[model samples]
Target: MKDFLAELIEIPGGSGYEEQAAELIAKEFSRLCDQVHTDSFYNVYGIKRGSVSLESGERPKVMLAAHMDEIALMVKDIDEKGFLRFTSIGGVDQRILLAQEVTVHGREKLYGIVSTVPPHLQDAGEAQKVIKMKDMCIDVGLPPDRVKKLVRVGDLITFRSPLATMQGSMVNGKSIDDRASVVMLAEVMRELDRLQYAAEVYCVATVQEEVGTRGAVISTYKVQPDIGIAIDVTHGETPDAPKEDTYAMDKGIAICKGPNMHPGLTEKLIETAREYGIEYQISVAPGPTGTDARSMQISRSGVPTILLELPLRYMHTTVETLNLDHIKSGARLLALFIASLKEGWQEWLKY
Candidate 1:
C-alpha cells in the first residue's frame, strides 16, 4: 500500500485533469474485472457480473466508488521576476502555504515553491500574521523568459511531498485522502475476480470529487446500483486536533453515518466489523459529507449509500499520514462483506 500510494501522489491529477490517474486505475481494474468501461466523464467502472442467479427479481448491484482527484493549486499569473502566482482549486489551509515545494505540470517537470517574506524584512505589526493567497507567490528559480516558455497561466501545481517510510506500520505522503481508498478497491477487485461473488460488483474510480463530487453523478446515473459505498479518508484527530470529534490512525477503518448515510447500510457495516473482529470506529456527519456518497445517493431518484473512511491526519495538506494496517484491514472487511451477502442479501437491509 505504501508503494501504491507513492505512485498515485507522483501522478499529477487534480480535478479536471484526471486522465493520467484514470488510465493507471483503469488498467489495474481491467486486470481484475470481467468487463471494464469508462463513461464520457472519465469515471472508470469495473464490472464483475453476478455469478449466481438472483431470486430477488433485481439483485442490487454493489457499486464501490473512490474519487481519484486530489486538492491542488492552479497558476493564476506569472510576474516579471519569474515568480508564479496561483490560487487553490480545492480547499486548502492558507496557514501552511509558506515554503511549500510544488510541481508544475508541463511538458517537463517544473519545480517551484510558495515563498514567504524574510524575517528581517517583516513589519512590526505584521510579524505575527497569516498571509493570504494574494500575498503568496511560487518561486520557480528560472529566468523570466524560460519560465514563461514552460509554465503557462493555467498550469496545475501539486505539493511535491514524496512518500517515505515512517514507523513500522505508518506511511506518510501527500494525497492520502482518497488514494488509499482507491488502492483498497484495487486490492478488493483482485479478490472479487478470484471469489466470483454473487452480486454484480461495480468498482468505480470517480473524478472531480475534490471540487464538487461531479463524476459520481454521471457514473451512478449509468451504473445505477442498488447499494453505493464510497470509500474515502476522514480526519484523524491527534493531540493538536480534538480527539472527541476525530478518529486516530491504526484503529482500522472508520465507518461513518448521519443524514448522508443509509441507516440500514450503516448498521450492516458495523455489525460485519464486530462479527469478524476487525478493528473499526464509528463516525458521524451532521450534514452533507464531503465524499462521493452524497452525489451517489441523490443521483437518479435515490440510492442507499454508506461511507467507509480511512483515518488520515493533515487532510488536504502537503503531507497526509495513514497506517498501512488500516488499509489492509479495510480491504479485508469490505471483501468479507460482499461474501457474506450471498446467503441472503436484502434480509439484512430490511431492518
Candidate 2:
C-alpha cells in the first residue's frame, strides 16, 4: 500500500492534470476486468461481468468511483527573489502554509520551501499574525536567471511531506485524502477477482474531483449504473479541531447520510460493515457532500448513490492523515455491500 501510494503522491496531479495517476490506475484495472474502456473525458472504466448476462434475467449495474486529483499549487508568478507565488488547486488551509517544503515540477524537479520574513525582521507583536498566501513565497535554491530558465507559469508545486507513521496504526502523507480512496477501489478489485459476484461492476478511477467532480459526472452518465458508490475522505479531527464534528483517526470508516447520498444504500452499507465485523461510524452531511457522490447523484437519469468516507485530518494541507486499517475495512465493506446487491436492486428501488 505504501509503495503504490508513494508512486501516486509523487505524481504531480493537481485538479485538472490527473492523467498520469488515471493512466496508472487504468492499467491495473484492465488487467483484472473483462473489458476496459476510457471515455473522452479520460475517466477509466473497467468492467467485471456477472454470472447472469444481459441475455439472461436482468442484473443491477454498480459503479464505484474514486478521484485521482490531489490539492497543489500552480505557478502563477515568479519574482526576482526566485520565489513562486501561486494559487491553490483545491480547498486548503492557510494555517499550514508557513515554512513547508515543496517540490516544483519542471523538466527537472526543483525543491523549494514556502518561506516568510525572518523572525528577526518582524516586530515581536506582528509575528502573531497568521500566514496568508500573499505572505508566503517559495525559495528555490537558485539565482534569479537560473530559476527563470527552469521554472515557468503553469508549473506544478506539491507538498513535500513523506508518509509518516503516527502512533501504531495511523499514517500520514501528502494525498491520503483520495489515494486512500483509490486504494479502497483497488482492494475492491482484488476482492471481486477472488470471489464471484452476481452484479455487473464498473469501477472507475475518476479525474478532476478536487476541482468540480467533472470526471464522475461525465463517466456516470456513460456507465449509467443502477447504483453508485463514491469513496473519498472526510473529517478526522485532532485535539486542536472540533471534536463534535469529527471522528477519531484509526477508529473506523464513516457511513454518510445526507441529501447527496441514498439512505437505503447507506443503511445497507452500515449493515454490511457490521456483518463483516468491520468497524465504522456514522457521518451526517446536510447538503452537498463535497464528494464525487454529489456529482454522480445528479447525473443523467438520476443515479442513486452513497458515500463511504475515510476519515482524514488536515485535508488539503501538507500532512493529511488516516488509518490504513480503516481503509482496508472500507474496501472490505464496499465489496461485501456490492456483492450483496440483489438481482432486484433496480426493481426494489422502483418503490
Candidate 3:
C-alpha cells in the first residue's frame, strides 16, 4: 500500500486535467477487475462479476466511487520579470502558497517556487495584511522570453509535496484528500478477491470532485447501481478545532448517518462492523454532506447511498495527513459488508 500510494500521489491530476491519473487508475483497476473502461470524463470504471445468480436473471449491482482530483493552480498571467501569476482550481488557501515548491505543467514540467514580497521588504503596515494570490508569483528561474516560449497562460500547477512516511502508521503528503480513498478501493477489491460475493461490484475512480460533484453525477447515472458507497476524507482532530466537528484518527473509519445517507444502508454498515469486530465511529450530519455521496443519493430516480470517511488533517492542503492502519480496517469492513449481501438484498433497503 505504501509503495503504491507513493507512486500514485506523485502523478499530477488536478481537476479538469485528469487524463494521466485516469490512465494509471485504469491500469490498476484492470489488474483487479474482470473488465475495465474509461469514460469521456476521464472517470475509470472496473467491474467485478458476481459469482451468484438470482431467479430474476440479474445480480445486484454495487457502485463504489472515490474521486482522484486534487486542489491545483492554473497560470493566469505572466509578468514582465518572467514571474507567473496563478489562480486556484479548487478550495485552495492562498495563505499556504508562499514559499511552497510547485511544478508548472506547461509545455514541459517546470519546477517553480511560489513567492511574494519578503517580510523585510514590506512597508510598515503591509506586512500585517494577508497576501492575496494575485500578489504571489511563481519563480521558475527562467528569462521572460524563455518562460514565454515554454509556458502558457493556462498551464496547470501542482504542488510538489512528495509522500513521506511519518512515525508509526501515519503518512503525509499532497493529494491524500481523496487519493487515500481511491487506494482504499484497491484494498477492498484485493480483499474481495479472496472471498465469494453475490453482487457485481463497480469500482469507479471519479474525476473533478473538487470542482463540483460533476463526475459523481455522471457516473452514478451511468452505473445506476442498486447501492452506492462514496469513500472520502473528513476533518481529523486538531488541537484548535472543536471536538464535535473533527473526528479522531484512532477511531478507525467514520460511517456517516444523515439525511443524504439511506438509513437502512447506514444501519447495515454498522451491523456489519459490530458482527465482524471492526472499529468504527459514527458521524451525523443534519443536511447533505459535501461529498460524492450527496450526488449519488439523488441520481437517476434515487439510489440508496452511504458514505464512509477516513479522518484527515490539514485538508485541501499539500500536507494532509492520515493513519495507514485505518485503510486496512476500512477495507476489511467493506469486504465483509459486500460478502454479507444475500439473495434478499432488496429487503435490506427497508426502513
Return the TM-score for candidate 2, rounded to 2 decimals.
0.93
lDDT of each: 0.84, 0.81, 0.91
Assess the local accuracy of residue 198 in candidate 1 as a C-alpha lDDT between 0 and 100.
79
Query: Candidate 3, residues 205-291: lDDT per residue as tens digits?
Result: 999999997899999999999999999999999999889989998988999989999999899999999998999998877898888
On lDDT, the stronger of 2 and 3 is 3
lDDT of 2 by residue, 86-177 (tens): 87888777778778888888667999988877888988787788878865788889998888999998988888877877887777878877
Judged by TM-score, which candidate is best?
Answer: 3
Taking all chains together, each candidate's TM-score versus the true structure is 0.94, 0.93, 0.97
* Candidate 3 Cα outliers beyond 4 Å, as residue runs: 125-127
Supply the global lDDT for candidate 2: 0.81
Cα lDDT tens digits for candidate 1, 1-351: 566678887777888888888888888788877888877667888887767666765555899999898888999999998898899978988988899999988557788889988888988978678899877999888999898899899899888887876888887888777888989988777665556467888999999998899988888888888889999999887898987778977778999989999898788888888998999999989998989999998989788889999998888887788888887889888877776676567766664
Clashes of 3: 0
In candidate 3, the residue pairs with backbone N, CA or C atoms under 3 Å apart (3 or more residues apart, or in different chains) clash, namely none
Q: Identify the superior model by lDDT, candidate 1 or candidate 3.
A: 3
